[model samples]
Target chain A: MSNEITTRMGDGERVLFSAEEIREDIRVGTAQAAERAGIPALSAEEQEKLFDIIADPSRIVSVQPGEEVIVSDDGCSMSFYGGQDGGGVGAPLSRMQAVLTYERACGADTTSLGHSDYSFKPVKPIINFEANDYYNTSMVTTAPFFYGAQPNLGLYFQPDGPCPNAAELMPMGKIDAARQAQEEAAGHLTRDLVFVGSRLADVGLEGLNLDTSGSAGDADFLAALNAVARLKEKVPDLPILMGASGEFIIGMHGEVEYDGQRLAGLYPQDQVKVIETAGADIAGVAINTTTTESLPWNLSRSVTFMKAASEASNIPVHANVGMGVCGIPMMEQPPIDSVTRVSKALVQIGKADGL
Target chain B: MNKEIFESAADAILRGDPEKAAEVARKGLGEGIDPLTLISDGFVPGINKVGDMFECGQLFLPELVKAANAMQRATDIVNAAIPEGEGQTRGRIIIGTVEGDVHDIGKTIVVSLMKANGFEVMDLGRDVSTDRFVEAAEQFNADIIGTSALLTTTMEGQRRLEYKLKETGLKKRFKTMVGGAPITQRWAKRIGADAFAENASEAVKQAKALLET
Candidate 1:
């Protein structure tokens, strides 16, 4: 398809883009659109750099099998693997192996990767204004460039929130804004095999209060589902990962309206239907509990949630490992064994059903 | 003494039905039911059950928050009925998610659980600084100071709070409690924290235990 496209924006306004304009201007229109909508815009230099790498396939570099690639700033390098799937192509296992080997080589415990008492000053906020194609392309390109030696580096994108110029599209209502957002996402999907679409909740939940009304919540849910649909339409092979608290997913699956009602369920099996209906490739439940403090509960709950998600889609399920539980605040560093056990459990689950 | 009515109140809290819990609490108080009796026999038991369910993964944070809301509503009605000078509290605690950490779901769960268990919690919210922890503890006359950090990078804030307590010579004046996903009992001990709670129920136990010590 030619780059010339007449896209209907969120506000019922048709944004006419000529193939020549996009080729010449790169992402100046996206930035200008964001600025007009009162959202932040990236610096000219950053935008140029970002577009340069994405627009030109020649700028993208690949590592050959067994070639040494740098993994960390501390001069860490590892032999490259050819596979791209986690167990099959990606380097989750091999990355761990490299780390293990590196530590042993340095006369440190295989577990001692971080410093016992590392000191750092307060971090300044890094303003990120390019929240559209530039953002997606940057992540899609960067994550792999550093860790290209590892297996399965899929372009994981989460455009659950509206792009920077979303409000400009909002004149047409939430549905239109959502549709426009999806259209923008489609632009990003043209170049990369974005393997995973995550943070779908970001579309609805962003900039909204936690006590969002049922109508608003419903709109968000629809928007998220639509975002997934849009991404999938663009890249049929892309896997969509839906992120939310297990309770939230349970509520959605139960068709619980956003009336601020506390949704209680003994199990998450019922929530899987929503995932299937939304066309999610994998279910990602937030296991926001401390690994060591609540090991048994954490493991059991993760397994149960994953099993429910798995049963729903007959697909692999993943957990977003968050720190703390009801009583816990956060841990400095999780125990090596805790990390190992959880990884092993996830791997086992993946091995059994390819989750 | 209308035991069935009191039981209904407890059921409302357990079911996370705040409106029902409040309605029953108001009706019971109008009928001259003792405030302490309503709390002890009605709300406390109900919330304890919620705590148990939460620990076992039977109830998640949303359910726990609902139950806490119910308990709070009932507790407010019951507490308002008692004589002004006769108020009782388990302990006054100041809790917050530490600096550079914005995770609050876990902290919010702990806050609700602590409230359900009768602790007067002053939640300073997320991304709180060390001086703020010390300042809040001092201002609130807190018996316990709790800090939560979700990231490994921000976990140092907990240690910083511990250090500030020492530098200010308030270490012995207030008990320090540390928790989070990565915080183990060892880290708590290493940082000179008085207690390390694994979950909400354990937090209650540890808070009480720390005060006693």
Candidate 2:
């Protein structure tokens, strides 16, 4: 029998790829992604090293048995948000408690505290110029518990709220109206982020995660960039981690631009440069997982894009490594076999600072 | 003369200009063009091109959504002007995000595509219970029921929907489709769904196939 290497697809199907084929995939995938993103591709030596790591015979691979790297999470409230019922029935305090326990058990470099609403939009009305103080007080109450925790504590929110609101105008056959609304919404989101960010910073919040920054497309990405700029100005010391929703920004408004570069169709490498310009401390890069493709294909593509992103960024590049991104399966609890391999590849081959 | 209007109609959709697309439909109707012809020969071709571009990664979600909106605008005007009993939908579909999953973008795109493909779709919105799927399907006389679950935690709701339909003896009455980021054909099979679509365009194709059989 032939000694072909086997791996799982994004859909968990077992597949085999020979050593030669896997290396070719890495080289071709990395070059194509680099060319498309307008960034430097991985060298031949780097591609061969990545292939070796992926083609390891073991079911799971890691940097070493006990070694670790910097790790941070987006949407940290999700575990408690889903809870036992999976209906977001759990309390926010329980989420904080879980984080503290996780830190105590298995240390993380950073942890985020957030509400289930996750987006700045819902909290905007609740914070309402301090008139209604419910949500802010909850944040204040939870901020102190993480003061001495091993992991750095940060607040998290997505800039996804405005895109849907703007899309509402499109169904009415108002294209320009939708574009204008997105612009206006970006301004409002910037203000809300600064307000919330400053308040949380006062309560010893260490960092802020702008999770899933471009879910609503170009307009959504602009809001995150704008927020990051304003937050740095307002809370100069607060580190911001901006994680993208996908590899490429969708052109929802299709006309909005940032720093003279069109936000639409920007890949991770190009995306991180703007994040650094906006003064974010970490650029969280994500590549979409194609469920139909083999794990080798997805992993190679993810690493290729991520390596470009890492090379382009002056700030720390934290690859988003779970749930349909960065070669991880789109499952709730991603299989460790794939997760370890992806993490090892990204750090060893992609040069990512964290996951 | 007619060819010029058809090309403009298609171009308006390609540019994702909803107002212009609707204007073209109105202009065509005023010029004595058949409503069906404006849709089948004009706008449908434009949307089909959008789908192909999207599949090949040339277009993104924003363009896809806008094109769908443009197609909807043109189709709405043409469909309303169709001779009384000649406006027949290809099939009826009811769709929603399964319980505890608030993700709606994927399902919304599927709804837009289904409508663009001449399927009568009633969107049930997000966080819909399994019972609501069966109830809505029966009420709308739907030929297919589509559910989306973006989270791995919420995928169980799709299986629950399948079980609820089987228990209510309505399983065979309507084809069931499951789709989302975490959903796969294997999961669909395990959950007893009739089909699983990887994306919105595939959802339309699956719905058509489900209706045929």
The TM-score of the first chain in every model comes to: 0.35, 0.82
Task: Tell me how far the alpha carbon of residue B205 in candidate 1 is from the true structure, in angstroms, after superposition.
Answer: 4.2
Write candidate 2's Cα lDDT for B1-213 as tens digits.
888888888888778898999999999999999888878788888888887665534675556667877887888899899978898466989999999877665675677667657677888877899889888999999999999998778999999998888888889899999999889988999989999998888998898888878
Q: Model 2: clashing residue pairs?
A: none
lDDT of each: 0.49, 0.74
TM-score of the candidate numbered 2?
0.78
Q: What is the DockQ of each candidate?
A: 0.05, 0.23
Instruction: Score residue A253 of candidate 2 by CA lDDT.
Output: 68
Cα TM-score of candidate 1: 0.54
Candidate number with greatest TM-score: 2
